[model samples]
Target: MIDPAYVSAMARYNAWQNENLYGAAASLSDEARRQDRGAFFGSIHGTFCHLLWADRMWLSRFTGTPKPSVPGSESSRMIEAWEELAAERQVTDVLIGDWAAGLSPEWLAEDLTWVSGISRRELTKPKAQLVMHFFNHQTHHRGQAHAMLTAAGVKPGDTDLMLVDLRG
Candidate 1:
């Protein structure tokens, strides 16, 4: 089981990495960003869209915020435009940071019950473990994005967790 401090630190790392990725992505043209690079999500824009969609879904589960209208299968196309996607990403990152800041040890120790979107079944698990998965999912997709960016001749800076600035 994890604690609020751990949650907060991961949240900070998430936001920091997001900023780096988005900033580097901004340098690419629309066509370049949308080019199929043979990645799972197909392209940089598509991967980012799916990541944002997944973040919203997880946030909705954790905070009771409204979930994305599109399902996971269609996540890569969640947002059509890069500008819109980036804007929503910034907003979502802030929301995640705020939610992490409010997490308590008691909440972390509790269980979270929710219907699985992928399996379409009711499931319950420890909040701490779910939170860990949530952040891990972000890292997983972001790593793909980072590779895509690097292949496209962009540098997103250091991704090491120790490089993240915890101070907000």
Candidate 2:
């Protein structure tokens, strides 16, 4: 059983982690951030792009926001410029905050059925399951990006859920 507070807290943590991730990225050279680190997405920028893509996909299902122009596209957008990507990521963080705040406990137990752009098939699952997967998916890939960033000498800030500001 997932509490609504837990969802909100996790959303805050996600936003906080992303802020730190992009902030650390700011310290790295353009070539370094783009270097291949063998991550599933290849580079920090690439993983970050895919992470945002996944976030947008889930957010669309969760809140009915506009989907991307390309569905299920995983190739990292050529955000060759770092500052733009970071700024947009911050906006995404705030959007995530509002999205999480709107969710109720009952909504999590309902089901979501949507056309799978990746598989091109109709898929259905409990909203709780999908939401859990959404956050978990972010954490998992972000961990990969974090490891790659650390290897490249960029240290993201604290990741503990306890450190996230509840009022954020």
Given candidate 2, what's the lDDT at residue 126? 91
Candidates in order, TM-scores: namely 0.97, 0.91
* lDDT (C-alpha, whole model) for all candidates: 0.93, 0.82
Best by TM-score: 1
lDDT of 1 by residue, 71-158 (tens): 8999999998889999999999999999999988999999999999888999999989999999999999999999999999999889
Task: Show how many residue pairs clash in every candidate, following the order shown.
Answer: 0, 0
Can you tell me which runs of candidate 1 are displaced by over 4 Å? none
What does candidate 2 score in Cα RMSD to the true structure? Answer: 1.7
Clashing pairs in 2: none
Clashing residue pairs in candidate 1 are none
Which regions of candidate 2 deviate over 4 angstroms?
165-168
